[model samples]
Target: MQSLLKNECSVLVFTLSGLNETMENRYVLFSLTALYYPLIVFCNVTIITTILLHKKLHEPMYVFICNLCVNGLFGTSGFYPKFLYDLLSHDHVISYIGCLIQIFVIYSSILCDFSTLTVMAFDRYVAICRPLEYHSIMTNQTILKCILYCWLAPFFSMCLVISLLSRLTLCGSTIEKLYCEIWAVAKLSCFSTIVNNVFGYIVTLTFFGHAVLIFCSYIYLIRKCRKSIESRQKFMQTCVPHLFSLINVTAAFMFDILYSRYGSKNMLQGVRNFMALEFLLVPPILNPLIYGLNLTIVRQQVMRLLFSRNKCDE
Candidate 1:
């Protein structure tokens, strides 16, 4: 009986040994991880600084941009270092507690991303549909309350999901993806994952569902803007940022769903590496550039900042 138990343990270990090895030689992964932080910091910092320095940008839209910059910075910094370390070391060895922390942070950040985008959509809705009442409706106190709600909603949601994930008894494999994703880790459990799947779908509905509503809201908003012929340029300007944000969010949700549902071994691994680049690198880099290059005020501020720095050096 003891010999049989020992054999079972040995087989389990042997079968799972190469799990992390499949992620090796991913230089693009390494480059992305290394490049992610500096770019995130630079873009987010520039955004926040540009907004703070210019009194003209203290409106609701820019306020939300500042909030987004802070959220993106936290998300990038919180997830990437540990993820990069895990990938390079080929160590799928995360403590159960560590795994829980990782899941909470990741899901919370994702929630923040989605919620902020939704709030930004509402801001556009008000700006386009109810321009006269925009100021009274989007007061500083109201915006602050929205921001607080955005953070809190995700905090509670992720806590519930993390609790459900923790109850799953991991038996088959310890090494999940390059990082600890709740769904991926839950699949390795010995027990049934019916509850996990159910709750996951519910969470997806609540979060991503809100995103869909926001998308529809934008569609209506654009139609309303078109009817208000006087502000056509202003309407398009307001929409460009939201349009980019919408595309990024949709791509992320689709990639995650596909990878979770139908992804095979090689495909899953490839998707994992590329998804980080797709979601993190592209949006952070593009958002600031879009706002900076397209908006005259932002472009002038950035150019002035650069010009001042060069003169100071001389």
Candidate 2:
């Protein structure tokens, strides 16, 4: 029995059961995802390219927005290709290493979203609250450090999580969700996952604190802006989009976290699937649109680029 259990613990490939009941609609789903995934890619890519090519749009806020879009592409790439493949393939199995990489990419991207937003909020605060010090404080070096934090913090955090997950002896080989997630993988462990849970909560709380700080800072910004029309306009133009993106991402994360931790098994599979996929679906499409359309400079630059390309084709 002990040897058999040991053999079972050595799970090399994990079966993803998230698509089992939805297989009948595979072709329909595939068609939609095939159409939609590229749109997500294009939108994010356009924003990234627009920001990179135009020197005038290279401010701290635009740079952060560009980073957000890049992270969108990064996160969605981790899920969409595999998901599109699974929509057609009968087997929804992933190798152990592949699963770990997917988790790292997707979750780290999510964390990067929060980190970038935190820095963007700070940029706005300085630009509005202490206008004189804005350029000095948000120097090229500062922006680079902020970008590093956006990526490296999540990378190291997930490294610890994947390490913890790799150490566990998984008793099962099936994951219920559409993609590989830390919690889903951890739940398969044969032993108690108290440490993993603790560490996961620690990360969660730390980011939650970020959200809180951003909110508080924005409130102060709002109060300060009320006295000046220029500040008010800037807040509406820039901060509103950030607020919208924050709300969208926050809601998406909340849904996934709640569903993963406390979702009822009796719930419909479609509902479960949507809850799991909301973050991936909504944010990638939404973030780019929010920034590309809302920021006047980016919008003008994108339009100019499109016109120039068309003229070149002629």
Candidate 3:
């Protein structure tokens, strides 16, 4: 059994073949990434720093927004550095342990986005639907718990899936994407991956169900908003941004999930790669902009900080 186990587990480093066709454009890709990644960092970090520095913005809703941006930074840290290196280097490979770590960081961050959005949806529901109870309900302890839930649940789930993947005897060392992902690695297993498939489905449905609940909550909120102009204005200002974020993340994740499971091989590699990358690329940039533009207090503070800094410079 030991000898059989050793024989089956032969893979040491995974050669990422996703960059094979794109090598000719590596420099261009590298240049674009060099410019783009820091922008992602800039956007997310600015939002996070803005929220933290301002005392007035320390409320539950803004706190949650700050957490979302922080998760964006966490997710991209797993991919961007390695991806940039791969773009420069001739060989695109990652060690088994490195691959597992990448999968854990990126996917958990994505899941945490879902969890954060869900919690934010609930925050809005309470604020709009039950204004009198918002403070009592969304207390400091509740915020801390929600933050913990956002981080822990996905971490635990991905840790379980990675533990399962680690136990499997992999027969291949070539990953088809630029970055490591759970399903990509699981597909390389020599034995039946029934457990992995089952768990993947469970995780998908569980988070997607979070999306469902968010939608339902909005449905009721919108109905309530219709009766009062004040409520209608609040919904237009605050809830609309949340709704945009929810839709952005959902669509991006859906593209990734569907493409991973059922994507056509005939599709262009660039298209496939884009589908894989959309979640990481879009949301990090979009969420801050959405919130920054819409949320009155945050926008006021941001603009105030910017203009104040200009005065200092002048």
Candidate 4:
């Protein structure tokens, strides 16, 4: 009881211990991070720039892909800059408000990815399953609404999460992740986190329902396309990449959640960090590359832009 009272819920700075046992390779880690973060930024920016400039690539599908890349950048920005800084410095601590902000940014971007992918699935459903009504259903106004849903839904979800977290009376200040995470911070609370856990599950189940809808839509699409060779070919060309991305993001999210909640200390620190980071590391780079290589229009425009630039240089 005395020790509990002494905890006081007054910690101003939260210490991160994810790297505490692995500081021997700080320089190598910093060097790799320094190189990798810029690569993520470059790839995402290229996609966004390509989409915005090319009138032909300005379709609803491509626009959603651009938004996914943008969200990737937003999510990485929340972690990489501060992570690189922490690698250089001996101390790794974040202010109370900074932790809240980081949680909001990172998680919201994740949820936004799901929302954007949901839109993409619907776009493909209309395009392949109901070809004639594609344009009428996926109008400029409809695209605008989809964009709003992608950004605004996640923003509102995170706002509620942050508000709830801010009210908690924390009993500790040590976080065991590479960056601020919602569950890690909530675990420090002195009081009952039943409400937080319930709301967190609600959010989890809601986004998961997004995944279920995407999966069901694909089932109908597969059945519909089975009748027509051209439709099958189109599904393979376009929908395959979206399927890959969905699987990739879903796996990463599962790893992070499972490891965060139930990870054993017997496991290697490096392995644990990888689980925590897989989502941020893989999806951001992989999504752009997958789409860029697989999509004929985007790839052709990219090559044209490159060849044109080469000719100019010569």
Candidate 5:
């Protein structure tokens, strides 16, 4: 009891042990991250800028793509900057409050990805399935509401998580992950974390429900598009990118989930690190590339923007 009280009161910092075995290669890792992080920023920013600047691309689909890119930036920001810093530092530690903030930013951004994709699936459903009512149903105000739902829902969900986390009395101050994670921190709690665990499972089910919803919608879309070449082309042009992005994000999230729940100390740290970093590394860069390069109009507009900027420089 005395030790518990002392631990509970003294837990102010968390030592991150994920990098302990990989410090020998820190410089090489830091150099690569420095290069890769900027590339992610540039790609997402280019997609966002192209959508915002062109009046013709102001439709719901483009706007949602822009929101997606913005979210990619938001989510990656929660991890990459701090990760780069940690790679160079001898001590890998985070404050108690910092850990909570990291958990909120990282996890909320992930939930927001699901929310945005859910809204995008709905938009595609309306556009392809109910073509006549596409404009009417996806009015500017409605689009605004969808965007708000994407952001606000995740924000509130994570807020509740952070609130619950703050109430726990932690007996340990070491997290075994590269970044502060909610489950990792919760595992350190001195008492039962049944509430947090239940809530976490609920949140997981809700987001995976989003995936199921998107899959069902795509089934209907595939059936409807099969009847007409025009609709088929539309599906190929638009829905394919969204589908690819959904699959990529889903796979990455699954990797992290599996790693978090089943990863063992006996396993190699590099493989474990790869699993944890997959979502952060791939989805941010891949989302923009998938959308920008796959969508004709977005590709054309990006090229035109680059050419025009070059001409101005000349």
Candidate 6:
């Protein structure tokens, strides 16, 4: 009888220990998801709504901002709900198809974001550098074509990369992080990921390289504008928002590179968390604030919108 009781006690202890570990991991994931997702949703929604309703924000610049907000919304929506559920339910297993979908959404958003920013920089360059031809160069049809290309180019690129990535088979460790990021899941694949890694590097170089060039072009344009005192003040105000947006985009790319290169068993989990925050959380929060505070038109429109809403409530 004593031997039987001792065996039961051992079994219970082992089970409790396993449960404790699971609970601890779930707690950590839940905290992270809660911290980042709400802020992302709020900021994206604010930017989208503000641009859509405010007639004053119907210009090319705000149109690009609206596109960016939409991209952020889709990107966050793709991963955060499932991530939150996985954390709360302690079910970290994502199926192959699900993983592929997450990768598609993430990469598509990344591509669109970079492409949109490139177009925005080009728009700024044309407006400031070639003021005489700004209207002719940025006609509605031309802007529409640019936006379409930005959307379609990234969609196809991500689809191709994901198709290749999906061919690889994952064999071990069904439990991933709160969400199924491409590299995180790829690490568990039984097959070689050399092609995927190489393709990822290519994608990074293409998108981020273009972003850097666009940023430099804007800086050059700003330098030229600074010769005139009035134009310099206006240029600074306009450039500040773009600079903030560039920082957000660049930091996301840099962190992605770091995560891809050094993410192994030896890598610190905190580093991964930091990368996620920079990539997923910071931009959404910062973009609207940057635009709203720096752009006088947007601030006035936002105030008007709020006032109209308050009056309606009465």
The lDDT per prediction is 0.72, 0.92, 0.91, 0.92, 0.92, 0.71
Question: Ten-residue segment with the worst summed lDDT in candidate 6?
Answer: 11-20
Candidate 4: the clashing residue pairs are none
Per-prediction RMSD in angstroms?
A: 4.0, 1.1, 1.4, 1.6, 0.9, 8.1
Q: What digit string (tens of lDDT, one per residue) describes model 2 on residues 1-314?
A: 69647755578999999999999999999999999999999999999999999999889999999999999999999999999999989999999999999999999888888888999999999999999999999999999999999999988998998898888878888999999988999998888999999999998778777888899999999999999999999999999999899888888988888999999989999999999999999999999999999889999998998899899999
- Report residue 129 deviation for candidate 2 (angstroms): 0.3
**How do the residues 1-314 of candidate 1 rate in per-residue lDDT, one tens digit apiece?**
56544433533321112235456565766787687667778877887888888898888888887777777777666567766675566444666667678668766877887888888888888888888999999999989988897799889989988988766555555444555677777777666899889988888888888778987887787777777785567767877777787678668766766775666666555556566335555666666777777778877887777788799999
Q: Can you give the lDDT of residue 97 in candidate 4?
A: 89
Off by over 4 Å in 4: 1-9, 310-314
Query: Taking the tens digit of each residue's C-alpha lDDT, what string does model 4 give over 92-155?
Result: 9999989999999999988998999999999999999889999999999999999999999999
lDDT of 4 at 71: 96
1 or 3, which is superior by lDDT?
3
Clash count for candidate 4 is: 0
lDDT of 3 by residue, 93-209 (tens): 999899999999999999999999999998988988899999999999999999999999999999998898898888788888889988888888878999999998999899999
Q: On a 0 to 1 TM-score scale, where does candidate 2 land against the true structure? A: 0.98
TM-score of 6: 0.85
| Candidate 2 lDDT (Cα, 0 to 1) | 0.92
lDDT of 5 by residue, 1-314 (tens): 99888998898999999999999999999999999999999999999999999998999999999999999999888888989999999999998888888898888888888999999999999988899999999999999999999999999999999999999989899999899998898989989999999998899889989998999999999999999998999999999989988998888888887788777878899998899889898989999999899999999999999999999999
List the lowest-lDDT window of 10 residues for candidate 2.
1-10
Give all TM-scores, in the order shown: 0.85, 0.98, 0.97, 0.96, 0.98, 0.85
Worst 10 residues of 1 by lDDT: 10-19
